[model samples]
Target chain A: DVKVTQSSRYLVKRTGEKVFLECVQDMDHENMFWYRQDPGLGLRLIYFSYDVKMKEKGDIPEGYSVSREKKERFSLILESASTNQTSMYLCASSSPSEAFFGQGTRLTVV
Target chain B: DQQVKQNSPSLSVQEGRISILNCDYTNSMFDYFLWYKKYPAEGPTFLISISSIKDKNEDGRFTVFLNKSAKHLSLHIVPSQPGDSAVYFCAASDIVSGNQFYFGTGTSLTVIP
Candidate 1:
């Protein structure tokens, strides 16, 4: 079994605050993804990394950035948190055929 | 435009019965389809998958059927259990982008015991 771990399960921050979400996978997969899930809208990709120190913007990448300094760790940074950014964040990793996901982090901005 | 769509937002079924969830895709280039199951506050988990070369694939109680002509797919869970109640998402991808995928909004399934 593969384990993808997120730094926080739940978080609350005030507007204009900077937030960082961390994800680590034990399986050493080549691809990593960050997504924000909203009701009725589904999971929208925010960022994805194919290798260490390489990142690509997904469909909804505004106000967000990512860092991947090592093979097992990927991080998502919210430069300035806002109410609209409050949603469930998910982390996923994949090789070529299958993808695995972390438990997820629920973020709230007020 | 939503390329992949799961029209039904929710479905309910009785235990020991079969639950069918449908998904449709408008892109003809999609060569691989996958199903993911998500629980509350958790990331989606891979459930089953089907490649374009095959029309049907089965694993345990979950089976996925793909129709290339219609660009449609369905997941059938036979003898559904209460534990199977969750949000199911349909995803599609092509080989051009190294398996980059597009996901549907998802359908919520509830199994009553």
Candidate 2:
């Protein structure tokens, strides 16, 4: 089965700490995205990479960054974790037809 | 501003009845619309999709209707089962922007048995 794997299902971090959430896809899809989901806000895109070494900012790119060194792996980085940044982070890879999502990582910044 | 909106935050329907969820988008450029079903603690799963050229698309128990003129869309579930209870999200893709999708806030649907 095709898979999009997120490194952690849950995480707890201290404020101001730099955090990394890694994602890997086995489908070799060129388009990959990172989104943060919250109550009453839905899934807001943080960033998306259409190809290796290429990235674009989404609707909400403030306070977050992304890296796509290889086609299969896309990493979302929280430069400095804050209490408000606590949300469910999701990774997705897409083909022309549809996008497949990971299990998601819930991050709590204390 | 939220480009896509799900006005109703929650909806409940009796078992074996039809459940309807609505969505509206502010952008007229969105050409492709999709519905996703999400269970708690899990990612949303793709449900049904409709292109701008088509007004309605059906897949088994689910049907999605798009009204291009009004910039609105609706998903109908026939005989909604308890298992159908979950958060439903409506997403839109602008073909001009390489099919990147924008999602609505989502509506929580409950099907009572």
Candidate 3:
């Protein structure tokens, strides 16, 4: 079975602080993605990396960035945390056919 | 514009009954469709999928049906169990672009014992 592990299950940050969410996959998939899920909005892509050091902005890229220094790890960075940024963040790795997702990190900004 | 849509926000079913979750997409370019199940505090897990070439795909108790003309798909869970309770999301992608999927808002399924 494929395993995608996330660094944190839950996090709380103050306004104007920076936040990092990490994800790692054991499957060595070539594509990694970051998404934020909100009620009635579904999962919106924030960023995605097709290869190491290669990143592309998804539909909702504002206020968020991503890093893929290695094939197994992908990280999402928030430049300045705000209350609007609070949501469940998910990481996914995929090949040609299927995608495996991490458990997700619930971030709350106060 | 929202490419994928799940009109129903929630559905309730009794155990041993059938549960149907529907999804519609506006983009005709999408050739691959998938269904995912997510629980609170957890990421969405891949459940089943169907390609545009095929009309139906079945796995165990879960089956996905696609209607290319209407750009719609539905997932049916037979003999629904309590464990099937979760938010179900429908996603679509064009495999030529390396499978970047667009998802629906999701439908919360509740199974009553």
Candidate 4:
């Protein structure tokens, strides 16, 4: 079975605190993506990595960054948590046909 | 600007009835399209996909229809069950543009039992 695991199911952080959301996929897929889902905005891509040690910004990458040091692991970083950053974060690994997603992480910033 | 868009924010359908979700894209470079179903607090799951080369693809009760000339696509769910209630997102990708998937705003679907 294809599996993508996210580190946290829910998290709460204070403003100015740094946050890290980790994801790992057993499929060893070449592409990994981090996205945040908002109520009306849908799923907007934050960052994506096509290969290890490589990262590309998505539509909304203002307050976030990503790292992919290893092939199976991709990490999303919140430089400093802010109230506007509170949302559900999703991670996905994609092959040529489809992308398998992790459960998701709901982050609340206060 | 949103390259892909789901104009409908919500749709309520009775059980055993057909549910249709629509999506439109502005970019002509997009050659591949996909539909994903998402539940509350869960990540979206792949439902179906269609390529530009093909106009339609079916899997079980889900069928995706693509109209290249209109830059539109729709997903049809036959005999939708209550379990089918969720948000549906349409995504598009341009193979030439790093194959990064672009998603629409999403349509919330509710199948009443």
Candidate 4 displacement at residue B109 in angstroms:
0.2
Error of 1 at B10 (Å): 0.8
Ordered list by DockQ, greatest first? 3, 4, 2, 1
* Model 3 C-alpha lDDT versus the unseen true structure: 0.93
Which ranges of candidate 2 are over 4 A from the true structure? none
lDDT by residue for model 2 (A15-59), tens? 999999999999989999999899888889999999999999999
Docking class of 4: medium
DockQ winner, 3 or 4: 3
lDDT of 1 by residue, A1-110 (tens): 78999999999999999999999999988789999999888889999999899999998999999999999999999999999999999998886667788999999999
The candidate 2 chain A region of ten consecutive residues with least summed lDDT is A92-101
User: In Å, what is the interface RMSD of model 4?
Assistant: 1.4
Clashes of each: 0, 0, 0, 0
Pairs in steric clash, model 3: none
* For model 1 chain B, the run of ten residues with the poorest summed lDDT: B93-102
Work out the iRMS of candidate 3.
1.2
The C-alpha local distance difference test score for the whole of candidate 1 amounts to 0.93
lDDT of each: 0.93, 0.92, 0.93, 0.95
**lDDT digits (tens) for residues B50-84 of candidate 1:** 99999999999999999999999999999899999
Q: Choose the strongest candidate by lDDT.
A: 4
